[model samples]
Target: MNSTSKGDRLEDAFYHYLLDQQDRGELIFGAYPPENCRIYRKKAYYCREREADVEFDVVLELYRKGRDTPHLYVIFECKNHEASISEVYVNDFSSKIGRIFPHAVKGVMVVTSRLQAGAEKVARNARMGIVKYDEQGLEIIADRRGSCFEHSFVRSQIFRSANSAKSLKFSAYHDGEYFSSIDRFLGSLEPELVDGIRPENGGGSLPVPYLSIEQIKAAAGKILKFADYESGAVDLVKVCQSLSIDLQFADRAVLDADGVAILGSANFGRKAIEINSHSRETRERFTIAHEIGHFCLNHERYLRSETIIERDLFVTREKDGSFNYERLEYQANAFSAELLLPDAVFLKKTAHFRRDLEMRDRGHGYIFVDDQPGNSATYDELLSRLSTHFEVSKQAIEVKLKKSKMLTDQRKRNEASPISRVFAGLISSRKS
Candidate 1:
């Protein structure tokens, strides 16, 4: 049995579990809890089209001042712990849903338990799905179901991750029903997936624009216009120091928390990055590194952009899915990507990227790197070199080649040129 002293320990445990899962995948994230959106549970409002009188538990308003307001959706409902049905509950919630979700293609349900067989029949009559806790963890997610806390967090992330959609809207959260500056991020449920990370051309079989992530980073750096690539992050820190005159660099924050960096003289003097106690070691470090990238690559863009206000860097979020998807937030993400993995750095070492793959451990996925230039020219040598260096399956190297644009279509299809289909098939079979 779970300890109930806190706000549902089992539910809280699941929240932690969700964090763990996000780390293993590619979800840029943030956390929004139930208390923040509590008001959304009890706000009085007229029905859509003024057809009836009703109040909303969660009212997701669409983006205001945005041309794309149609993209966002809102929902609200009560959560229960019981498995029994209540028609009164449905009648009230259904009315609210019809109002706020005027054209809502998606929905948010704050409900009690996952369905019981009898409850399912009742739910069908409501023309919607009920979000309930699954004790057995065997539920299919046709509807995006989560606990009050979990649902809020996911919706916040989803809206945040919409990336300049201008679909940012207001809702609930642990903090309250306010606007979140950075939109919510798309969430994932994996913790250790190792695919679709690097482009393939660097491995030397294709026309990948560059050799590696470093190269990609470098190219992006020029595109972003850094003062000097040689200075790299050191130059970036200096810039941050200068920006601190008008900025605030956060010394610490929980992972994916609503964060801001203060160039506060006192805060800067403390060297926020050096403070370990207040932030998540891994996430904070990663975020700092990412911010440094932005500093190096995007400062000019931000300074020159007319839409961003001096104090606009900070936005707010309610507990559930409430945020703004336009402007600076996504810009920061692009900055982080370009700074951390510049294109030139990766391009310079493109021929040798396969050599790094030798370090991959089995069950961890495959990697390949080559050393000898003479041997690097041949596909077999390159593949062998990558296998030894990265410890990845040869098939992975092939995909990497495809991503890089190194292999020719004929080689992949025909059985005659430098590589044969039959031969490729044979090599693919020996992945073990």
Candidate 2:
């Protein structure tokens, strides 16, 4: 017979989990258990819209002891099931949250299985959150905080991996939304490059000259000289400025696009790079590096005019469900990966750190760098560490590792669940 009740076990698990998050300084209060905290288990709230009372799994709040306005409030609806969490569940949670709590309260739908397609988007649109926790460490599927905590979260690397719409623009730069930013960027360029910058014709009638892989590699090598190869991190802004390229940050709405842009010979008589200000620092750095690929590979030579603008040479996809593999975009993406985390250094660090990790025999999932032996880290920890050292996102590191055959290729070595295959597939598809 089971000793503990399921309800009691769930409550205890969540209580302890929150306590651990508190100790780790994940909570906004910055105090363990926090002051004036209230965790109402199986609480009922009257829903004005529904004209009925809805019961919640857990309602957690932390704020000033006597203040009328709460600093932070989170409502979590737990779902333990084999099926994935769908849009319907997310919509229901959003509706309940709207009726039950103030606008500032963040709604969280905690699920055991994965989230279905469009579910996360629904949650984000509703200003709610999603958490997928299991024996593996806590994976924040989606967590949209209220305005008060948003600034802090944006600055926190802990929540840096949240999914955003910006990633979509990389696939199709020609989308209607992207034209505004592209036009602005093109208009800012100098007349010389903007007016008559065309590829050197080589007897063929083709107007543009396609760069070879060797040429791209050579260009990347030049940029890598300015970076710390051992650390696999480059000062992209400094490198750009060294080449007379100005770095500019603009809002996403202004760009109507994702990623960064390399402006050839701006009106200031210098090259420029426009990065999406709303993106994370890691993302900005990668975008800068990607743009550097374009500069070094002489992609501007292909630009004919402002009206016929060349697609960004980093992330442009073609029809038939495949990326434009034979284009400058693919080459630039390849260059960015190689530049950000050089193969040799990346492999060496992973080999050494993973060896040490193996000796320690730590557990899986998110782990602090200096975590204890029994509470060891996962591939995610390794990726996070590399990301910090390399100044990129864990996803970037993971992709690099996979490309280098360190995360895959079982013939070389054997390790159970080197990384989450599901996560790897998800991230890979997202990139494509």
Candidate 3:
């Protein structure tokens, strides 16, 4: 193949590989506990020393939801080329990892090419696992190139090509997919430095009075207005418009087709927020509220750079508002969920309807299935009636509950027990 054509094909394949993994919503981390954590790729990782030697596009830290996880890290490496791996290469990568995230407990690597001599052996010897992307596909996966998103990459730790975006969309928004499980997982994450997140100034912060779930929701409610007809897609569109951050209600051909993001122009006019239109009666509303969290707290910092990392995946950040992939992803998700499902709403919902169903630390027994504001008080009913009304999903609601310590658990568990996804495959996903 011509050099240009070869590069183009490689690029196409590279993205396709990412998208396919994205759709499946997971990665094959390894043979041990952290082995099964799900991974969501962001812009990539970079750490500049002084002025340059600045590391270029490295794979973001892999992700995995630990059970009652106080904090667990999913470390990973990515190399997109067709070459064999080896002891020298693995050792070099390992040494680099040691320097970067010194305290990290574990890590994984993605060699999207042939494994070099002694590479697999070295990885195995190091007690790490290797995933190879070659001419062939996963022997266990039926779809092979078609793809499936578990967001918990432990299934088959290997790949050859990417799949349709639809599969990932399914993993992201569906009620029963990885997100729901993530809700459960989040429900279990314990705070590191547990204490009141109060700031020095008491004039009420931009989004809330404090760094908390209740405060975030309260902040969102103050900023947004909801309409009764805001169901499916229309309501989400209206919410986005009401906020003034900028968004459109575009349709998608998926299960959680709440809305599709237009990618560029990030959130209408601003370059930070991506303009996504969702249609889920409950989910779309929650998404709108969630995006509001981003606008209120993160937009400006992000717009300063063309490469906005999705979700605060990394827990680390720089002064100029740049951060690692995992931190950004986690922050964005937490911010959104906090705003959509605040404690005030939860309290009221339980107050009015506490008599009807059984409430537990993780979730309520009510199977709220409303396409709009009426039925399924699970989240909407609770939030709508509270001082700060915002629509959130039961999963998100549960997550909010755990984060606020409404429920108590302080350990992160790497969930390896396979379960069906909340929603299997769809495009426009936010990592499972």
Error of 3 at 166 (Å): 20
Per-residue alpha-carbon lDDT of model 1 for 92-181, expressed as tens digits? 555656655565433334332333444444445654534332222111111121111223332332223333221111122221221121
Candidate 1: clashing residue pairs, number: 78
Instruction: Using TM-score, give the best candidate's number.
Output: 2
Q: Give one digit per residue, the lDDT tens place, for model 2 in 199-280.
A: 1112212223344545555676676665433354776776776677777766643321112232221111235665544346
Best by lDDT: 2
Error at 203, model 1, angstroms: 29
True lDDT of residue 168, candidate 2: 19
TM-score-best of 2 and 3 = 2
Q: For residues 151-198, what per-residue lDDT tens digits would candidate 3 score against the true structure?
A: 333212232124211111111111111221121222112122213222
Per-prediction TM-score, please? 0.27, 0.39, 0.33
Per-residue error for 400 in candidate 3, Å, reads 4.1
Ranking by lDDT: 2, 3, 1
**In model 2, where is the ten-residue run with the lowest total lDDT?**
169-178
Model 1 stretches astray by more than 4 angstroms: 1-54, 58-75, 78-92, 95-125, 129-215, 219-235, 240-247, 251-286, 292-432
Q: Rank the candidates by TM-score, best first.
A: 2, 3, 1
